[model samples]
Target: MGLRPRMAISDIEVIAPHFKRRLSGVTSTVVQLIPKQLEAGVKISTLGPGLPDDLPKLRYRDLLQCWVRPSSGKKRIWHARRNIEMVAGIFLRDVLRMPMKLVFTSAAQRNHTDFTKAMIRRMDGVIATSGRSGAFLEVPHTVVMHGIDTTLFHPPRTNDDLFSASGLPGKYAIGCSGRIRHQKGTDLFVDAMIALLPHYHDWTAIITGRVTAEHEGFHAELEERIAKAGLTDRIVFLGEVDDVKLWYRRFSLFVAPSRNEGFGLTPLEAMASATATVTSDAGAYAEMNVSGSTGMIVPAGDGDALRNAIEPYLADPGRAKRHGENALAHVTTHFEIGGEVKGVSAVYEATLAGER
Candidate 1:
């Protein structure tokens, strides 16, 4: 797609506030979406701490600039994806008398706390990240599913020697990524790999995520189990990879065994990388993949089911490549990154005109 010239500071139309410093799903969403918005000529800038230095960001003191009405629009859109950011936006617009409209993106798949509902009710507009999330909302919201940057996560030009390039052993790799914890179902992934890898010597399994201090015991136990099974070399743990996009492209099958999720973009990330996936029915994995064709979806937290889903690919690498090809096509047709940014752009326009 063509990028419109980046809007100047004076002409900025949107303020994407990210209060959290951690690299969470919400933070990742902002990092992915802002540049797209700017490329589309929507004069956007990020605000708050913990964002990458590469993003166009306004200083905290720049919050005062919102009080100045834009020459072209009535107010700026304060797009928020978390409660703290949303609450701050409301206070800026209402109490501080800033010329801004609050828009909150809700991704929770179940009922929310009363306090959260009360906050939602106060927003100028709300966006549900998935259709499933809309059911759990008390206030009205537009549903805009998350999308992946196809350019960043596409099929490699040639991956015949990817393992050699990655400097890891084995000809083929299956990977599961996310935080190392029981809720993320990392244990299930480890167990399944331990049970299956002995037969598929050509295939190695990798887990890429960090184990927090609180989950040290849980992480240690999984390592002990793998050590006892004598599969340490095959079942490897790559804690916290900054280049996860590269890792996704190296996998034959990308498994997301999450026990629960608000909504996950990992399946799409895997698909965009031209990797076949075996994901749990948690989050939007089922919605993202055409089960059994493009990818597979198993029952959440079921090691046996996950292993069964992955066995055929281990037996037949060619079929796995075909599935990966299908995944790239499916993601391109339905979940390209531009599709998501365009949807939100429309909302911004309508809401600016007081029509949303």
Candidate 2:
């Protein structure tokens, strides 16, 4: 069940396809879920590139075996999270006449294009990452929220551990991680830091994420703004690191200031790291956060609202600490990776049972 590919063709109950070669959110989700799903007793295997060698996998040539009935006498479930994967699943099932059922998992909250709508209609079972995403689907689907790996994102040993690791001139470190672009609300986080950091000397801001070529101008302008405010030292940028989960540990407070998102995971990751968050109401953020309990939720794309939500944490470090504790407890109770594996397995079970 650990790292070994399920080589026996008859043993595979589910086939998870990742058609894209680039490392994306979908790729990360597949990489994280498959091992946990296998450990949970789901006979699942991945297909395609960009995945680690350890996980259970199948070669492209092995797809020929899909035509043979599984030993269980049930159609193998083909789980897809992207359009290209869905199309490939359709071809395998319809054109090649494979003994398989197509299952599509959608995380997008927007209305589907005509092509996507047609593709979804052919799915034997569909899963949505959040209720908001489910609302956009014209077909019936199960809402299965994303979960984090708590073992990799646990809290630090001491309250000062965040400052100790960073060695920055502050008692607390505020953090935002993801791609640096307007859609991700990098500018909003910077503006909030510029407005609030001067007043709160104990707190410093850290941004960790890649600044892609297209967003270079946007990144430069934010730097200009921070310099003009003369708070460049307080608002630091650590552009794109591999071990972001460690950076999550180095945060007294986390922020996900996206103007738009598709089931944002940073807030959940932050919560699992025992750091309270101030996230905008984008993607499933409102679903993950309990306002004033675990963390605050501001209106998306509103800089003033974002600033107001963050000011409370700066004004009262003790309250932030309490909220961080609450966040940890909430995520541990409801958003562990095991819970996601179980929910997805339920869908596979029902689909295999011939329930639409």
Candidate 3:
């Protein structure tokens, strides 16, 4: 798509508190090249705690503007608070001094009535990642769905290769990948897995991720439940793998049991990886998942519903494969990297032009 008339897009910066190495290799690479591709004479910069000291510096004049999404803390609640404070400090002090416009990514960070009202008041525009988030903000904003690297995530030509590498033949594998914590609803997933064990003996659940000390007690409880259910052989914990794509390719089905999300990326990744997904109908899953098409959605925290949703796939391999194919098609058409960049760039151009 050509640039809108009279619109001039400028330098773009993404401020992720902690960037994932996997995403940096693909999505970040595309993000870094957007300005050049758009021919917008833009320079991009990233600033974070982990930013390298040896990274090239940009003078004030060379920079067009700064967009900041402050880093969240380890504890979810504390993290939200820290993010609010950081935004206020940046907008009230530094951003206000500059002639450039300010854009924020989240309502929790930009529109919190108690904490972020001042920051919201200062921003030129707010770029929401989902319609639900935009509604929560109750502000003028554009909903831009985050993009995935479709090239990296597209459906494989042959499942034979993936299956051979996985070493678990003729068994249905249900996989979940993300942080192991209360907010993610990992407990609910475990309960669902437990419920499915008696009837589905050939089924296995693969959990991949680490748990923090704050969640150590919860982790122990989960382990105890797995032992009590006698699912030691059925449930495998792979921990955190360096290459998520490998595991994604190996999965027969992908499950996301999150309670809330700004815009869930894992499901999109799973969809791109061509895995049938069963996700909780919470947060952005409602938007990302196409019920009975791409994947099934059960009510959040309902173990029975989760089990029921997943049972069909375990019983029929052909149905599961069809669902996975649909998921890949959906993601490729709607959530690819180029589409996401264009959506975000439109918001930037609109804000700069004072259209919103």
Candidate 4:
């Protein structure tokens, strides 16, 4: 059937779907984008489960109405961040004969699976989360790096402060957060902390994340190793936390030593919080760190390199503070969520204009 304008005034112009029940990079992206997009005057809503109830939501039944072309003679944008959501878009746009535009934002920095490639090839448009991720894509795509909420992550007021009022005993805490596994290099962070903290008594290294059932042994081994070094008092494991942004501000230096990632955002979040960052050259971390200029970037999985990168900051807290300021300025200039929203809206407008 030929395309026609949406009949209802309540139709959502853009829909960001959260299909899974778990919190992940995809869900976080969707959650962060909605408020910014809405501020820019886009009639957007999220569908499916797992999203916070605060943001506007469109019921799944409402999705059927979005099958028609939207008002202003434009195609409704259905942005998907995962394989299942992509498949749903295909069903809505191709199988169900919907007039929506199918868009997928890929954050995987590695090669695409044959099945994934097949699904991606059918998208009306593709958005790669980074140039590294784009390089692995077999289809034409736009590169839009994720941005941080600078308002929420901005530097703390003067005076060293306790984070989340948890009374964690350090003037400055160094933290590495994410899923605890070999791929995330949590053990590397542990080893680096064990080697460094005895000398720099003022700073304590902390790791915050969930160790899934499969990685329990790996987590236990790391903890045992930390205990053996008599550094358990210096190296703390907070597990998963809800007030992570608050914790980021308490960190004078934030470490992300992942052996692999898909454009990791923790470093950016740290920078936005005005914290110096040390990251391995996995994902687009090198892009975020700017080497010694903004923060530190080291070789991935090299415990020695990670330790070396952090010592300079530990040795000179003044330098760490200045680096944190530079990081804040850099993120405000280049990585604010406002800029990301603008980029996505530009793509949406172009897609509506029939410029694939």
Candidate 5:
């Protein structure tokens, strides 16, 4: 595929591996085809704790003009210091020589108030991932919805071999993907699964992703709760997988029980794979899921609501299939990767052209 005009995005912290993969995949594909189009470059390259050092290097001319910011001592308080660092970094590294337009992705790694003020004072433009996130910034920022690789996440074309292979043949498999942490509300998902176990015996819950050390105790606690609920035979925890598209294909239903998300992309991926979804009304879930139109949404942190939202689908596969088909159609129409690239490309052009 040919690259559109090049624009650099900051926020190098791989807070989520999937997020990093999407960013790198999208940008690199565009850069490969139209290397010269990337006149405006990205900076602030920070990596995750254990990310490989041999990652491929980007070659846009403006990329050579960029520099990464040094992280501070109190990493948890990094957001509070990020605005100051961003302003200083921009002036010293990007603005001293020439006036190049910038398109900052996330907030300045600081409190919303501080980050908004910093953005207003520093950046030439902004592209927020969701309306709620954009609202907090209170800038002339555009709500640029995230995109998914539909080709990679499309409906399964093969047989249900994986279901039988995982010993779940003839049973519905509900899957949730994300870091197994407190903020993600994996405990809530566990609670819901526990509640549903007595009623639904022909269903399994598959949770995938890595668990943080800070959440080790919580993980243990959840496991004990699952065992107590006698769901050991019903719940499967598959640690991080290289290809999540495969997981989505195998799942009959996808659940996003997160407490907060800037803009949940997992549901979009699942929808693309033609998997019905039940997400908490957290963050951007409402915008992504149309209640009964695309998929169902339950109140955040409410295990009962989550369980109820999922029970109907578990009882009726035909309705679930209809919801999944609708979801796939809805996401395809609204969140195509080409549209995302075009929209972002427009932002870059307008920014560079100084078209407020």
Candidate 6:
């Protein structure tokens, strides 16, 4: 799509807020979803910093115009994905009396805090990312799982030399991407690699994502363990990367061994890249993979189970390739971005009509 003119505040039917300045999973979701939502004819604009310059957005001062209701008789929708944004929505609608309805999307699988529960109770509509997350909510909610852009994440062509250019010594790559922390099970993945890589000499292990100050000790511990195993050369860490999809393309096998999560998307992204996955039963990971056909799923936080689940794929490259193909087909059919846009748009329609 080409650059478009700025939209009038009165023309917007939905305002998605990205309150956080740092790039995160939620920020990525907002960036990916809005363009598709607009393509599907939802009159939406974002309200916050940290978004692309090309995206339709409102100025901070534009909050004053919210008092002027949209051209449609129905109140505009204020879709908040974070607690802070929810508070902002509540203030605008309740205190300032803006003509807007509040909607919050919950992705946390754990029980809600009383503070969070109180704010949720004030929302006009709620959306849960998965059934597991929905089970924790006290109020009524629609289950609308997230999806990825299949066209952007598909397998690399035969002519692609992405791995060779990386200069890493391996014919195949096994990857784990996300924060390097205990909660993300980065140590479990490192342990699995230490146990399995010696048997599979042609494969190399790659870890990507940021390491904040609080987790620097955990990151050091994992690196030290790999060094002690004398596999430091075999297993590599590429800190945080700008082009994650390219790395996904280079991977023949992907792992997501998180001890806990809130509707994880790494497995889906890997699957879309035609990379087979071995993931723990955290968040919506199990729901995304078809176990034997697409990949394997083991109990969360079990090191033995994690290693064993990934062993079969390591033993046979042909088996991994077959499952990777299956993964591509499954994701293309079930988890395309359009499906998510449709589900979310329906909720917006229902909320505006006082039906949700």
> Which numbered prediction scores highest in TM-score against the true structure?
6
lDDT of 6 by residue, 233-255 (tens): 89999999988899988998999
* Model 1 agreement with the true structure over 101-188: per-residue lDDT tens digits: 8888888888889889888888887888888888898877788989888878877767542755877789899999888999889998
Q: After TM-score superposition, what is the CA distance of residue 309 in candidate 4 from its true location, in Å?
A: 0.9
lDDT of candidate 4 over 1-356, digit per residue (tens): 23223324345788888899887877778878878887889888787888777777777787767656666667788888889999999898888887788888898988889999999998878888888889999988888889888877878874444553556665568889898999999989999888888898888887888888999999999999999999888789988987788778888889999999877889999999989899999998987787787788999999999989999999898888899999999999999999889888877877777665
Q: Which stretches of candidate 6 lie over 4 Å from their true place?
A: 1-5
Which residue segments of model 5 deviate by more than 4 Å?
A: 1-89, 92-95, 107-111, 160-162
**Residue-wise C-alpha lDDT for candidate 2, range 319-346, written one tens digit per residue:** 8889999999999999999999999998
lDDT of 5 by residue, 1-356 (tens): 33232223232211111123323223332322122222223222322222233332323343333344213211110111134434543554355543234456552222476545765556665766667667667568767667666766798787752455566534778889988888788988888888876787777889998887788888999999988877787887887787777888888889999887656678988999888999997767777887886679998788788888988888887777888899899889997666665666566556656654
Ranking by lDDT: 6, 2, 1, 4, 3, 5
Error of 4 at 232 (Å): 1.4
TM-score of each: 0.94, 0.95, 0.79, 0.93, 0.77, 0.97
Structure candidate 5, residue pairs in collision:
6-37, 6-38, 79-109, 79-110
Can you tell me which runs of candidate 1 are displaced by over 4 Å?
1-9, 158-161
**Model 1: lDDT of residue 285:** 78
- Which lDDT tens digits does candidate 3 get at residues 1-356? 33223221132332223233233222333343343334443233432333333332333333233232223211011001124434633543374553444566662312466556566555566766677767777567788767777766666667653654577533667889887888788888888788776687667788888777788889889989999988877777777787677777777799998876556678988889889999997667888899999989988877778878988887886787899999998988887767766776676667667766
RMSD of each: 2.7, 1.8, 8.0, 4.5, 7.9, 1.5
Clashes of 1: 0
Any idea what lDDT model 6 has?
0.91
State the C-alpha lDDT per candidate.
Answer: 0.85, 0.90, 0.65, 0.84, 0.64, 0.91
Report the number of backbone clashes for model 6. 0
Which scores greater on TM-score, model 3 or model 4? 4
In model 6, residue pairs whose N, Cα or C atoms come closer than 3 Å (at least 3 residues apart or on different chains), thus clashing, are none
Worst 10 residues of 1 by lDDT: 1-10
Off by over 4 Å in 2: 1-6, 158-161
Q: Pick the candidate with the highest lDDT.
A: 6
- How big is the positional error of residue 223 in model 1, measured in Å on the Cα after superposition? 0.4
